[model samples]
Target: MARRGKKPKGRPVNGWVILDKPKGMGSTDAVAKIKWLYFAQKAGHAGTLDPLASGMLPIALGDATKTVPFVMDGRKVYRFSVRWGAETTTDDTEGPVTQTSEERPSRAAIEALLPDYTGEITQVPPAFSAIKIDGERAYDLAREGETVEIAARTVEVLRLEIVDQPDAETTVFEAECGKGTYVRAIARDLGRDLGCYGHVVELRRTSVGAFTEDDLVPLEALMEAAEEGRERLDAEAVEAGAKARVVDFAPLDDYVVAPETALAELYEVMLTDEQAARVLSGNPVILRGRDAPVFCEEAFATGHGRMIALGAIEEGAFKPKRVFGGRG
Candidate 1:
């Protein structure tokens, strides 16, 4: 007997789906929804987006799940709006207002502050974030009404441009940054720098790696497609045919990028059939023809128009660190 609302047995759908994650939904909940809609036997996300922040959430299905780490290492772009005059406990709208300031910085004052935030800078992760403290989540500690002091870490901020100043209370901006850079922390710091308490009122992630806003599929659209697939399967079952328990929501090859695409930043090596076979079989292969890139510890090996494995370049040899498809 199946439990009510339990998702049916899923299919091994290997690919990635860019979800324009709606506002007010946790990253975990969004993943669960995407999984159910696709009925994928395996699924994972490249990065976590808080409930308050919406936009691109890269969902990987089946074999694509193996490429998540590579995707997460890529740069992220965010368009966020900060509301001045009040600082929140969480550094976002969810927390209570902790401080308020009557003085708001003019556009010129804000523009002058921009140069200081760009490039490599130290940033402290917000107390209400997923960062672990003493093996427990920092947000968990914060929710339990505990004071969480996070250490400052260096994060590269590639671009920080003021896009708009709609009113006296809010300012909109776009940011391009590296992994581990916290927008909440930026808002908090900006507030302090300008002598006006501020917190993020709205945030939307525009891109993650090669996945961008153009690739995003709305949650409702995916759900509708899945429901239609279920109906078709039920009809087939009535005709004594096996029920279609699995569905590939998007064309894996056409819509979802190949695994090599995610490792664009890494040096790639093309392997012969025999070399690929050995690499996939958990064995190292010698690259006799060319010298490996200097300091190239990580690489992607490709063969037959597909990614074979992610490996380490050690001693002029490609040592398979993690193969794409589990086994040869």
Candidate 2:
């Protein structure tokens, strides 16, 4: 008989889980484990992490899934090690070696090359990446023994440093970059620039947007918490902190950063009860404080310290692009 999966239970879950994903598990698997633990109605992740990569992965459940785009577009920090003198098929340790060299650059040489990678620059995406080409996944094509062509894209590298060079064969680096930046691409390019070849052997993301490593909860811990809280949650029918506790794995809230807190860096607008109601209904309302703000532009809106919506200011009117917390 075919095995059947457990059906999801309870009402919609609305929050984020900053998971400290362990290496060897794919991003989808990590999300599935969390979703099953909470029996959440819906769940998704902000960004995809490679199986070989480990560290902070922010998973969104229910309404928090609406804010995923904002998080994916946010800044990212990574600490990785590049193995010198060999390039791999996948540009990582898991792939077979495609090229080799004995030329290893010194720390000074690597530092001199740092400037080239920093700031806005164009680079090609890896063939074994998730980028789509002609409506098909690039990685799938690469793995199928088909030729893959991933175009060069312009990405912003805010910071790139040669953190350490433990040996002649390895160079460790830390980078803070904007969306669409690929660490594997940097490794490959750096090796080529140094007259040798290189591939990423170790990669770990330290942070993504406002989420940090400190915000992460282990997958096992969350599963255990769900197991222990299941009976209480079923009996209580998910009242009070029931919803939160069911999935809360980090800092008593499962890293569910409030929309207001998450978007704290942006400008805010406080709506009246009537205006909040209007926004909740997906309508725009005029405001008094600002003078004719641009239309369809994004900003944060809140009421009584709670996030009401993240939307746009349109010609002295506030439009609700996304309503958070079922407050609508």
Candidate 3:
């Protein structure tokens, strides 16, 4: 019989890749491609961007995967164009049009209605969404000809405004919102209120957490960089007579940001080597110095510039909630 518990392959590459995912590619596929390029043992993404949407998709490798929740919880910014006079089943261009109207909302009408969508408001997720229905995905059920009714949930929209009026048929909008705010839903709701049906014709996520356009590395650029890096590695291996398939990963390091980038919103506490050691072993350590925080709901500790743990500070002690790599 073949061994069942074989060790996983790939290098233990750790960090984030702020990928500018192109349209027509899903977030999972983007992460998988990145993982393959880096030859990472484990990989995940901070948030899911629909296959129909493009732009920033933060791919996390190895230890960086641990910080994904923090990034997911952070605010997201999206710029999208909505096609007036049409509503789609998926609330995006990928879906078939379910309703249409000849009427179109004027640019002034959209601007005036923006406030109603901003702040905390309730909205229903699209039928073709990742939301679960009776333990099955809503999209899966919807695809199987089953009706999916997602409950109305409150979402925080920090800002929603008309950015451009491309034509009478389309209007561009930019929104900054908390987790679970769907851009598609925003477009759909706006169209309904304006007496015209609408759906997202073009959607792009510009920012998530600390990740922004500045941090974006286009998919093609990454592939090109990987090709060069892999070629160099292969040549070095041949010249040195090293064992084949060795992944140095140093050449591609320049493209990856540190894992701590996801925790930018959290307080950082620099620890002594001894304290770091204790934290890695899942122990709490007393923080000293006059400037030390007496209490923090969430904080990350680093020693020698390496992440040690993410935890809370309570009564002058930092408690390790999630420990990272062994003490460096």
Would you estimate the TM-scores of all the predictions? 0.87, 0.86, 0.92
**Best candidate per lDDT, number?**
3
Alpha-carbon lDDT of model 2: 0.82
lDDT score, residue 14, model 1?
73
Task: Kindly list the per-residue Cα lDDT of model 3 for residues 129-186, writing each as its tens digit.
Answer: 8888889989999999988889999999999988889789999889999999898999
Angstrom error at residue 322, model 3: 1.3
| Residues 1-328, model 1: lDDT tens digits | 9668766367766778888899999999998987876667888999999998999999898778888998999999999999999998999999899899999889899989989999999999999999999999999999998989999999999999999999999999899999999998999999999999899999999999877788888777776566554534466577885755434454332445555666678889899988888888899888876565533688889886688788788878888888876573
* Residue 61 displacement (Å), model 1: 1.8
Which residue window of length 10 is worst by lDDT in model 2? 246-255
* Model 2 lDDT per residue over 12-106, tens place: 66778888899999999998987877666888998899999999898888777877888888899999999999998899988799999989889
Give residue 92's error in model 3 in angstroms: 1.2
Clashing pairs in 1: none
TM-score-superior candidate, 1 or 3: 3
- Order of candidate numbers by lDDT, starting with the best: 3, 1, 2
Cα displacement (angstroms), candidate 1, residue 165, comes to 1.1
The RMSD (Cα, Å) of candidate 3 is: 3.9
